[model samples]
Target: MSNNLKKNAISLPGAIAMSIAIMAPAAGMMFVPQVVAQYAGSSVPLVYFIALIGSLFVANTIVQFAKRITHAGSFFAYNSAGLGQTMGFLSGWLLMSGYFVFYPQNILVASFFSSQIITQHLGINIHWSLFSIFFIVIIWYLSTRGISSSMKADLYFVGAEMLIILIVVFAIVLQGGADGHTFEVMTAKGSPSGWSGIFFGMIFAMMTFMGFESAATVAEETSDPKKNIPRAIWGSVVGMGLFYIIVTYSMSIGFGSQNGDEFAKSILAMDYLASTYVGDWLRIAVAIAGIVSAFAISLALNNAAVRVIYTMGREKVFPSKLGITHKKYATPVHAINAVGILTTIIALLMGFIFGPYPVGYGMLGSFGTLPILLLYVLASISLIMFIRKNHRDEFSLWSHGIAPIIGALVMLLPIYGSIFPFPSWPYNLVLTLVLVYILVGFILGLVLKRKTQNLVQDVNKIISSDGSEKL
Candidate 1:
């Protein structure tokens, strides 16, 4: 590696902002609540509750590694430290795939919301592809600037999104809800589809927690990384968890139990709720929040994907040029550009081949979910192994062992649900495609291990570095 990222460029709040942005609480409320309600019925809150618990366990497992091994590679470095170099590379590749897949989905979301807002308010009809390309270009520019700049933008966008959500949530509560709040929504008896539907709903429920671990990816850029990164990871889960539960509950009550079918059928449930409880103006605000949330996540995920590639490149697992940072900005310019261009190409291709809505919003969204859950399982396993073998003196049975095991097991539920039910054409195909991608990565890892002498040592040296070296 010949270039270094700026050290101490991000603070605790900045890191936390990025993590929350990546989670995209506003977007989750919009996209996930209706679908979850369709399956889990009034038990939507409970589904989010279960997902929150799983996210906490996974966050704790990640904290275990973040506090010990501070690296920009995040899951890549953590798995390498806990497992071996090969597994680490595989984890990185899988994690990268997750981000790559999600990038287009975010673009699609931005395009969709932007189109909706313009067509509804401005009375102008524009194709979503134009807005998608515009947003993608904006994301590319922001991400390539530097970590500090990108995260600062994240703070603004995420703060606005959260503010809108909170406004609508409080409005629902103060209005006493359409049917009044009750604990019945938390029980399986309230579910229209019963327990089976609740289990199926868990798959999407867990997906809302997808980017909570994102702070760890910026460990190298954060101030006091060993301390801040762990806090950001755990704080993200707690913050977003509370946000999801409250919004979901308010939505459940606001829409009223009698209107379950209406809530399920509505394309933008939260926006409809906002229009009913607050005002039609709040619908526009929610739409704006959706657009901002999508843009913020795209920026955050791009930042994360590039760092993983930069780390791998540094270790010679990828092209060495990808390891180079911008001389002035100290950002991973090469890797960022590569990811941006590739993401744009994929987004355009998918839009052309399958249309923006189906491919961008549907297929790409499903493509990322399974790999992320798998990565969570692998990271948890790596934590368990690392603690047992290396950090036995400091390890606690709960945080180091039991928590990760529970995390791995809880994550499996979603993975199983995603596959066993065998979703319709495109979604079912995503599972097979993700497996094929990982298989290819595993083969590549094996080849790299055989060809690159001292590959493990290089990875170790890079992860263990103190930010003074190029790494």
Candidate 2:
């Protein structure tokens, strides 16, 4: 094994695919809109639009940073360039936590939805845990096949995943929907609780866009990363942003916008819309595709998590063993296994504790979301500091200053929702657990204060001495 990841192995499309697949478009649309519908009512589309704006604010900061720093530890490196070793390590630590928790969500979701299809079509009884184990093994194997294999797998899966969902969404528009198309569904007036309710729904709406940053993690491995990584980041955010808005509006009207309560209450909104607007065959097809979408997500996230962990390993932030790559595959072998292994352990634990349907998915997904939101807040601050310190002459009042400030403030909405007027049990447990996890990292940072210079030096040497693209 060698301590190197294959450079220039990924192209622009591969990077774009990585960012989009991690969003799990099909799985996200299938699951999240209904949750948003609960408060936004028929205004689900409006809520998503607002969330898209918030995402853009964060995206701008990431894009600006990507133009200058290209490294495998995407966010970590960006933060390090601006914030120094301690804050940078903490940024990576929170992001790594988010990814580790995010991976098992796909295992649980894939098993939950696939289980429905299997029991309905084949008349076989199988526990979701069995399906969970099946998926865990498949993800581990696919990940080990190396970066090229994983990126190719996601391209096909995300394409097919987008196709089936779009067909159904467009079909609803053509049919003039269940209530003959009303503009009311797209208005703030559509919400049951007015603007406040819309704000609340924005919590889940923002969560759906969680994985858009997956592209940034592969900067070191991608060709023309300075250009490609920023483009990939914008491509995912804009592409998925529009996709989320249109599809949600279609579902709202398809369910007779006034029936938002019923829409939110459905077990699987996509399956319901498919069976109603098209046919049962379409529902079955979506179910099958949903499984593929979930797998694509699992695969994409595993690829990203490995790089983050690999970067940390190389810098001695974590065990050195995790820094090694396979000689043939040129993939971070130990990092890949660590991601898969942690996912496997969590899948069984959460599945047994909560059952893999609505409860398990909610608990895990929310747990994953809280930290990343905080990470973005910190990263936005890092952008300003990075620009002012390293590229002082180029810093702008807006781009490096005002924009990152707005981005940080925008991200605080969801972080606020996660706490104060606290979420109930389980979710409360997640909040508590995440706080303790971060606290532990903070304590570790203090303990290693003297060694921080070494940490930053190792992180810096990972990037070659070549000049960066100008801001």
Candidate 3:
């Protein structure tokens, strides 16, 4: 590792900003509003609220973990410190699995936008899978250069995306007032299914909010880790949550359940919402912004995944070659390449199986959510255990103890809904991916454990022979 490169690379604000932007894409109006509305009906905003509260609890646990022990591996290291080596390895593997699967998932979103925009405007039909592969390759190359550059690009993309979403929200609210509605589909009283539906709907809402805890993965390179990690976690929680509620509220009014036929036209929901309330030009702009958000997310995921691999390699859990830092680029070249190649292959395979464009994307997005949730469950448990054992002074019984236990149960509700019964096609696909990841991770962790054990034994022998051991 180049000490100078690491020192010069990241700042507290920059890291926080990067995390916010990366997370911001998941809360895009076009993304969250429709999904929430699908399950919760007029009560979509409540789902966002429920998920936000769950996220805040999870965020607190993560923040406490980050404050004490800063590492690039993030939740993996936290669980390891709190639980033990085997659980830590499992956490790291789960995180790695999510990061790897999620890269292709985001690219699928970008490709959907790319294909939709082109076919709609130019009336051109292109090979979406091939085009998506090309798009992923370009991002992989750019990411191999440096995370700083990737984040710099994200600054622009995230900004444009947020601006467009804000405009759409404003237009929707204005139209709602004109149509004589208060835009408070948020009323808990009217919802027939009530909080039951809201909680159920929140499973998907929480899926969209997966990347916030990811900020901790950058701690090794982030300046002022203590302040920035906490700020990034809380700031993202509030910012993304507010955005989700506002956008969903606007969409509910725009949807206007008054006319059954018109309201059911939620398939082209964003297009209809924008054209009806905003304008055709504004709709075009929002579509463009959605595309940019997808690209920025893809770049950010690539940056995070490569760093996780590098961290694991340095600890001798993964191959050491991935730990090599490039002298010129100050990036993890091998790790970056590994992510790129794997994602490209997965994208190709998925494209073949699912057909092209939007369908493939829906599958990837759904499949990717399961493993990410599993990782969160592990992290939440690790926080409770770690605080109870290591930092008993900093945390009390409720914050570290009861909160995490409840948090874990809450997190699992979504995972259980996803796997055993399989709610939807996307849910089923995601469950399969999660199972595959666990099976592979179990085998790999065993091999790594043996290798690590040998290294520990050698070190112990050296210390004992040198008479440097207290025992």
Candidate 4:
């Protein structure tokens, strides 16, 4: 009946590894390669660097936020505590929506890649949607098992994924494709868009690095969050940023100066190019990496989303049943089920809504990027406010105030660009989800609040007595 709950079952290393598994999804490197190739074209690696720098500001805000609050809901709770109730609820709802999207988005990616491997390796033709459904069910089952199981799986996935990435990089080096592709491309100008292309392409580029701040949300479960969370956040940012830069640059070079068409296909489209350089084995390995990468993203998001819903339930904002933890598994079974069901429905509908292209993949990715940036934007403002009003001792001018203020402003750019009219389908899909989510969560939260308030209050009262005030 006391306020404290059991800690996150995963260790700090496992959490970091799991977090890396989440953030370093190999699919990330493949996402904007075409956009970069199309607009920035040869200069796409520069876009990666540009995006990495911008993403670093967001990562800094996340690390700072983590230093202050150790909440399972990450930026949602941070925004709520730092800003106010309404904004916090909005933030939580937005974040929850983002996390919810992660499930389908990832399943789409995994299903697609898994199908590719099956078709290529086994000569079996299966529908991607069915495979996607199968993968979702498996991911849900694994998620319901516990964070420890998920994290352990992540360690294996992460190792395999990274190996494939290294193989691709090594292939590029061994082939001696381009002497200065990575550095020289930045200086080349696009056809009509020129620098504007890179600027706009930067939006897509930044999205690839979306999961770097995931460590903050899992802080409550970490063993020594104060030290570990901060370290993990920053370490993740720099490490993952470097990884993106290397893989992106390597892939572009491996594709050769004239192979823009091949690189334009998808993030791992270069895996085909890798075959030319390193042979068929590495290409198959890369496909396996993609599947694992997608699965890892699902694992991380499921872990975070379940915790978010459980936090809401614990706070009396949702049904208390959702707050229940499985006694044997010690996992948030109900919350996991709720999140899984919601994500699966969304994924199925997305398939119908957008057809074979997997609208869920792009829509989920875009929307996920926005709420995260908004959370950072709000967090930056909150940090400034939090320092000015309460903790003058925490103020270092740059660390507590100006840096976050600037960080918030910079983070706002993509959010603005994303919602504004763009010719891109991904942008519009993101915009639709953002507006739809806010409207849906607003109405739902209001109704759920009204319905659950008395119940939660009554339950809290009864639990406080431990039989003294029997129902």
Ranking of candidates on TM-score, top first? 2, 1, 3, 4
Q: Give TM per candidate.
A: 0.95, 0.96, 0.89, 0.87
Candidate 3's C-alpha runs over 4 A off are 1-5, 177-184, 187-196, 257-265, 424-426, 450-471
Window of ten residues with lowest summed lDDT in model 2: 462-471
TM for candidate 2 is: 0.96
For all predictions, the C-alpha RMSD in Å is 2.1, 2.1, 4.6, 5.2
lDDT per residue, candidate 3, 1-471, as tens digits? 542225436665557556666665533456655655655677677777777777877887888776676667787677766666666777788887767766787677677677878998999987667668888888877876777777778777777788777777788787663345653566653244666656666666776677888778777667677678788877878888788878766766666633322343365566667777777887787777777777777787887788788877766778887877788887778888888889888877877787544567666666666667777778788887766665567677777877777777777777665554556666565666668878887777666775444333432343234322211
Which portions of model 4 show Cα errors greater than 4 Å? 1-5, 179-182, 187-192, 257-262, 265-268, 356-360, 424-430, 439-471
Give the per-residue lDDT digits (tens) of candidate 1, residues 1-471: 246888999999999987888888888888887888788877788899999999899999998888777778788777876788778878888889988888888888788778877998999999888988898788778877778888999899888898998899999999878888788778786678788778788888877899989898888889888899988998899988998999988888887766666777888888888898889988888889988998888888888889988888866789989989988788888998899889888888887778776355878878788888999999999988877776578779899888899999989987887777677877777778888988998888778764333545554564456644422
Candidate 2: residue 313 Cα off by (Å): 0.6
Whole-model lDDT, model 4: 0.69
State, as a TM-score between 0 and 1, how close model 1 is to the true structure: 0.95
Give candidate 1 regions above 4 Å deviation.
450-455, 458-471
lDDT of 2 by residue, 375-419 (tens): 899899999987787678888999898988998887887677668
